[model samples]
Target: MSRHLNAGERIIESETLSGGITAEMRKLTIWTTDGFSRNLVLRTYTDSASLQHAEDSLERESTALTTLSGSAVPVPELLAFDSTATHCEYPSILMTHVPGSTVLADEGVDDRVPLLARQLVEIHAVKAEPRPREYQAMTTADTVVVPTRADAEVWAAAIDVLRGPVPTYDGRVLHRDFLPGNVLFDVSQNAAPSITGVVDWAGASWGPTDLDVAHCSTNLALLHGPQWGPRFASAYEEAGGVLSESTRTRQYWRVRDALACSEEVQSWAAPWREAGRVDLTPGVVEDRLDAYISMLMNASGQ
Candidate 1:
């Protein structure tokens, strides 16, 4: 595999990374004949009809990485991608390994929030052509099976507000899954950590800047408590991240995002648990969703 990646080189070490649900990721260390070495990440997706969403995500991620090379956005450089899974076990993408860790350290939220806010602003600032598919939040309407009354009521109210035409935003690049997990930072003993890379671009697409902002806000509220949601928005606005002043505009995105919280909570729980967050559970997620919905309602003056 190392020779395939770089001529005359061999893999010295390989380690699988943790906390990925959609794809399998591994870090490969390869040394050249003269002993020079480099690290790269190999990501592969299994072939499953049920996992089409994950496969599509990898495709978009590959496209985004290739598209954003040499751009200001801090993304991993794409080395190679194979859709046929000929080289590896499954369809794979090889990229330069980024040097940093996620913001899971017991660091002060105050210290980290501003850096997170500003970097997100930079991501939305990047330019991209609009993709044919528009971003859609997972509403209860998307479900085919019968839903409980409680779930029906929750989604019914959301559907009422979201029934109108899908609001549009200036076509900006969106990291659809923007959150603490996807953000990597380089931390030193003496200084503050700075963002090194924004990863997991499988969810990348074209949308309004605020859509990403709202998604991050939901994640902040869910993971940290509702208080952090407003703080994140304030920091973003203070750092000049574009957000609509109109409460209506903001809630349009927020409500759509908040309604999807249940699924996000379920999807993210396994990874969070693997990362040592045993406190995460479906009920906790529900409570967080309730708080977030209240926050959005208040923000929109509804």
Candidate 2:
């Protein structure tokens, strides 16, 4: 901590940041020699389980921040990282804080949806030399957790989509977890709401752009409504982001990502529940997921 701090600068405060499930996040306020305060965010993987992959996760995030440093994307500046936990209590990363709060309320999603779409376009457009690791699937057909009351036929169809071989795609940089919770927004009386920064790059990868879009779409479906899932895809196209030429191929990615969420729906809802969305019970999320899959299949004429 002392090495990362400027001469005569000292920590004045530390506050825990919520809405993250994987890592413990803290905001550190530093009082500098110039008599002003600045903030840095610390992300530490402290759990016994998380420790198993902490080094890899921290390495990915640090490399991502380094890769996107001069790009149009609004990302926090990486200050320091201890991927091995040798210099810190746990594997950690310290980065300059981006100003904004996550907006999870459903009322203004329509306004932010396009901005989210455009930001994703910018993110996917970045080129990385010796690209990040290939994206990995989080769920397989056998691993999918079907909702207790889900339409068996619909779920079977959705799961079947994943049983097929992974689709081939031109690789692009991916914010593998590009959901609303990872996006920061600034909403003020004086101006329109806008995205301020995107955080959580530990899952960054190189993959089909649709995978990133699918991840965010599934999250939007659970957070807002099933309609928002497909709505985001349309918004992405309007914002100049391209999807696969075949509807079947596009549906495969969408269904695959949506099913991945089913397996961890309960755990995923925990952070949103903590953030004041008590209405998003596990049961509700499961139902929304079912609806989103049905909608996808219907649109694809499956």
Candidate 3:
């Protein structure tokens, strides 16, 4: 911390920031020689499993921040990183604090959806040279967790979709985890709401744009409603973002990502519950996922 600080600057305060499940996030307030304070975000992988299993996560985030600097995407500026924990107690990356807060409330979602869609379009437009690692699937058909009350036939069909070969796609820069939680919004009273920044770049990758869309759509379904899942896909298209040409191919990706969240809906709801969305219990999320899967199947003419 001292090495990155400007001369005569000292840390004035530190506070934990929420919405991070895999890492510890801290906002460091620094008092500079000019008698003003600035903020920086420190993300630390304190969990032993993260350090042991995903050893290159911090390195990937650092590289991503470096790559996206000055691009249209609003991402934090990387200040420093210690991927091996040689200089810090845990593997950490320090970055300039991006302004705004995550908007998880159910109210005003209709207004915010299009902005989220547009910003994601801008993110995919970026051409990453020496791109980040290729995207990896988080769940397989065998690994999918079927909800107890889910329609057994529908769930079976969804799982079978994943068992088929992956569809062909043109690679694009992907914000591999571009869900609402990772997006920050500026919603001032007098002005329209807009996306201020997108954080959590550790999962950034080079992949099909549909994969990124699927991830966010699945999250929207769980966080808001089943209608919102398909609504977001429509919003994305209206925002000038193109999806896979075939409806079946799009359904395959959407079903795959939706099923991936089945096992972790309860864990995912914990943070949102803490953030004041107590209505989003695990059961509610599961029901939404089931509805979302059924919608995709029907849309694909199953």
Candidate 4:
């Protein structure tokens, strides 16, 4: 349609769509004079501004993508990153438009399932000494998100669990947002999405591979629910993953992480609560807590 230039150098056009509340994913088709069609996506961060630390988020995203470029992950090449934290420029990251339908929204993506597992595993295999302290140093990424924050033990235990010497992840990049939307596929081609490439390395970190899996699990659950989560976990384990007790802790990390962002949960769920609707926000935190507790219990059992 109409071409508009965002920033000074890039001339881009984006349109909004219905469905999902995280950010606005605009269908961006970049223009080239040579009749070359390049379709890229631009995500304008629209998380509830009241609860959002926009500047910090953009900083994380920029760093994570930069690190991801050198890691094992297959991320879309970065086109531009502008973190206008103070200038109020709406921190944005313009990414290379990789071509693939979403595994969560679109159907007929069964075959590419294995590669999803493979990609996570391969990307996680990269090692970094002394894992970074927090994921935000990573990226405004898609870490396994839990929509609540009303827990205490989860926070303490996560520190205890991850306190050990960071596993050697080969310094490869972690795709903090290794979910379906960030993933591109060639479902039309028999070869699965080909993974074509990955998007949102903003939260890429030097942590256990399980962090990647848990992140995938949590995000996929938001879109596809439990069915997708377990299926993805199973596929990951089946594909020759070098599983260990430590890696399993990533699930606990996910719980702790989700708890940390409880405010967001309160935001999305607050409306329902004010209207005297059955409050699910408490349950959201509870579910995450139970998962964390279960992880602890299982470890004791072992």
lDDT digits (tens) for residues 1-302 of candidate 1: 54356578888899999877778889999887787898999887864742567556667888888778888888999888776666667778888999998865334667888998998888877766545245556564353222222355444555455665666567677888888888888888888879899888877887777778878878777777777777888888888888776767777777777666655567775676677766766677567667666656655622
- Screening candidate 2 with a backbone cut-off below 3 angstroms (N, C-alpha, C), the clashing residue pairs are none
Judged by whole-model lDDT over C-alpha atoms, candidate 1 comes out at 0.73
lDDT of 4 by residue, 1-302 (tens): 22333323334566663333455667676666664556666666756651265445555566655555666666666666556633334556666666554454424435656788888877766654444335442212234243244244544554454444444342334566576666767666555346677765545555455556666665544343334555666688888654446534445545444333433544443433443334345565356444543443344312
lDDT values of the candidates? Answer: 0.73, 0.91, 0.89, 0.53
lDDT of 4: 0.53
Which has the better lDDT: candidate 2, or candidate 4?
Answer: 2
Superposed model 1: Cα runs more than 4 Å off: 2-4, 47-50, 129-136, 140-156
Taking every candidate in turn, the Cα RMSD to the unseen true structure, in Å, is: 3.1, 1.2, 1.3, 7.4
Model 2: lDDT of residue 238:
95
lDDT by residue for model 2 over 1-302, one digit each (tens)? Answer: 89999899999999999976888999999999988999999999988888888888898899899999999999999999999989998999999999998989998899999999999999999989879988888899999998998999988988899888887898999999998999999888878998889999999899999889999999999999998888899899899998888788899999999999988899998999999999998889899988998998888722
Report lDDT (Cα) of residue 32, candidate 1.
74
- Better model by TM-score, 1 or 4? 1
The C-alpha stretches of model 2 lying farther than 4 A from their native spots are none
TM-score of 4: 0.61
Q: Can you list the residue pairs that collide in candidate 3?
A: none
lDDT of 3 by residue, 1-302 (tens): 99999999999999999878889999999998988999999999887667773457877788889999999999999999998889988889999999999999998999989999999999999978898888889899889898999999989988999999999999888889999999999989988898889999998888888899899998998888888888898899899998988888888889889999987878888999999999988788888888998988878822
Show the colliding residue pairs in model 1. none
Choose the strongest candidate by lDDT: 2
Models sorted by lDDT, best on top? 2, 3, 1, 4
